[model samples]
Target chain A: MIGIDLVQSTAETLMRKAAIEIPDDYLAGLKTAAAAEDGDLSSFVLEAMLENYAAAKEDSRAMCGDTGCPRWYVKMGNEARIDGGPIALEAALRRATASATSSVPLRPNRVHPLWRTDHDNNVGIGAPEIEYGFEPGGDWIDLVTVHKGGLFGTDYRMLFPSDGIQGIKRFFLDSLVAFGKRGLACQPAIIGIGLGGSKDACMVLGKRAACLRVVGDRNPDAKIAELEDELKDLGNNIGMGAMGFVGKSMVIDCNIEVGYCHTGGMQMSVHAFCLSSRRAVARIYGDGRVAYRTDPQWFTDYQRRETVEWPQAQTKSG
Target chain B: MATGPNKIRLSTNPTDDAIAALQIGDIVYLDGTIYTAREGVYMRVIEDRVDLPLDLPAVSAANFHCSPAATQHDDGSFVLGAVTATASFRFSKWIGRWLAASGAKLIIGKGGMSPEDYRDHFVPNGAIYLTTVGYGTGALLGRGVKQVRELHWKKELGLAQAMWVIEVENFGPFIVESDVAGNSLFERENAKIAANLEAAYEGTKPAVLKRFGETDDRKDEMI
Candidate 1:
């Protein structure tokens, strides 16, 4: 069984990693954006961000003062068993979050929505939200931690089938221009677009598309992947770059994720994973072996499967 | 760093001539003392009429709209990590009065106040806005802090809202968002970008169902 102590320790490490380190994929993407950036102000902003990442690592401090809202995506294999059950696993995660909040010296950004009460530990009623996904096999649990900036760069809209791709593009530009002004959304960012699904699900999907996936990864569907490319080019061509300056580096990458929805409606949501784009992941096996990596590897073929039954044989063959 | 953007170093309690000479888009690094004060501190001083904790513009003329990633230990010593600014537009209502009351000359934060705000409040008060680079550079800023002099109202306002008095040297890399004459860098950039926005949205169409009170004007800013 996977030990609870191991789970807690690993979680603490993930939190620290998420706060201080810019993942390799995102760092590379930002470097590419920086190289292509021409606007004086925009280029300066990108260069400063590059230096900030290095400083964060060398000093072992958070890359951004507003460390963002820390959240978890726990993926478990069917046969996985913990030292305790799911409840114990959750307690371990919570403990890790609180401990790391103080030890990492992260700003206590979480508070009561109305009362504005601060726990100073980043743990309050429903704070540090824990979400889960289950895979088809293996006796292992994957822990993914994402520290995403909570405000701005996210929007939702309800549209009809008649609205089509044009409507999608319109809203996409609208969201980017609206938040990208004065560097509010912190572009050149990873822009995630969610099409289809219910309003809430659309938001969730878009957020996941932005936070969970690494740069340059595309949707499995060819048409959707093509749309992603088109959107990326369109965003960069808006003549806006870092801090909403005149330039061509607004979007480092564009990601689109879709789900089935009501026949008559096409719900859409847009999310931006900022320059920091902080995330880290680890997998704990039944034998107490743990492996850590940056990519969450969240969108497995199984996770996106449309068939009602697990097409085990076909998936294996493929 | 070498090719573009003229850079300057100024004191937190800068002279009027120093402020006047600055131009929008110039890079800046600050020296001397600064303090963190946001909505909570603003509301207390402006609305609640709370007495000033320390001498303002005397101890520091720089008002930073920030909450550092920090914590206090059992022995009362503090550990401050990253330091970055929050959006400053939200405090527009209290800004004029805060500037007047505190004699603040440097308002530092993220995503500067509106052009109107710069003209109406900042210029008249002999103040300017310095926007943090990267809307951050938190760790770099943290490195600039020589000392955390004091933290005020932690029990009353909590860590995020409490006033943090800090002393620094070479504490920046901020962009001059607004100058003494009230010209805003962001607005200038926005106007230039707006000239090309129509072409970018050429093939796109607005949503079939529009929300009430939504403006289709592409130039309109949400801030």
Candidate 2:
């Protein structure tokens, strides 16, 4: 069984890593953006961000003062068993979040929506939301922590089948231009677009596409992947770069994720993962072995399967 | 280490001439003292009429719209890790009075206020806005902070809203978003970008269903 102590310790470490380190994929993407950036002010902003990442690592401090809202995505295999059950695992994660809030010296950004009560620990009603997923096999649990900036760069719209791809592009540009001004969205960012899902699910999918996936990874569907590339180019060519200056480096990458939705509606959401796209992941095996990596590897073939039943024939052949 | 032709380092309590000499897009690094004060502090001092905690513009004329990533030990010592600014446009209502009341000469934050604000309030008060670089250069800014002098109203305003008095040297790499004459760097950039928006947005159509209070003007800024 996976030990609770191990879980908490690993979680604490993940929190620190997420706060301080810019993941390799994102760092590489930003470097490319910086190289191509020409706007005088925008270029300076990109260069400063590059240095800030290095400083964060060397000093072991958070890359951003507003460390963003901490949240979790826990995936368990069918046969996985914890030292305690899911409840115990949750307690461990919460404890780790609180401990790391103080130890990492993260700003207490979470508060009651209305009352504005500060736990100062980043824990409260629905704070540090814990989401769950299940895989088909293996006796292991994967823990993913994402610290995404809570404000700006996200929008939802209810589009119809009649609205089509043109509508999608229109709204996409609208969101980018709206938040890209003065760099509120922190552009040269990973722009994630969600199409086809319920209103709430669309938001969730777009957020996951931004935070859970790494740069340079493409959607499995060829048509959707083409759209992603098109959007990326379109965003960059908007004549806006870092801090909304005149340049060609607005989008570092574009990620699109889709889910089956209502026949008449095409719900869409756009989410921008800022320059400091903080995320870290780890997998704990039944043997108490833990492996850590940046990519969440969230969208497996099985996870995206459209068939109602698991296709054992195709799986075994593969 | 980052060098530019427009770079200028000034004291937190800069002279009026020093403020006037700055131009839009000039880079600035501050030395001496600065304090964090945003909506929470503004509301207290402006609306609630709370007595000022420390001498303003005397101890420091720079007002930072920030909340550092920090933790206080039981022994009262503090560990401040990263420092970055929040958006400043939201504080436009209370800013004019805050500047007048506190005699603040430097208003530092992210995504500066509208040019109208600069012309109306900041110009009259002899203040300018300096926008933090990258909007997340927290660690770099943290390195500039030499010490945390004091934290005020922690119990009343909580950690994020409390006033933090900090001393620093070479404390910023902020860009002059607004000038003493009220010219705005952001507005200049926005206007330039707006010239190209029609072409970039070509071939796209607005949504079939429009939301209430939605404006279709491409030039209109959300700030």
On DockQ, the leading prediction is 1
Candidate 1 positional error at B69, Å: 0.6
iRMS (Å) per candidate: 1.0, 1.6
Question: Among these predicted structures, which one has the highest lDDT?
Answer: 2
* A1-318 per-residue lDDT for model 2 (tens digits): 889999999999999999999999999999998988878888888999999999999999999999999999999987889988999999999999999999998999999999889989899998789999888777889999999984889999999999998999999999999999888998889999989889999999999899888899999999999999999999999999988878888788999999999999999999999988999999999999999999999988877788889887654442
TM accuracy, model 2? 0.98
| Residue A94 miss distance in model 2 (angstroms) | 0.9
lDDT tens readout by residue for model 2, B103-198: 999999999998789998999999999999987999999999999999999988888999999999998789999999999999999999999999
lDDT (C-alpha) at residue B212 in model 2 = 100
Question: Once superposed on the true structure, which residue ranges of model 1 sit more than 4 Å away at CA?
Answer: A314-318
Q: What is the lDDT of residue B168 in candidate 1?
A: 94
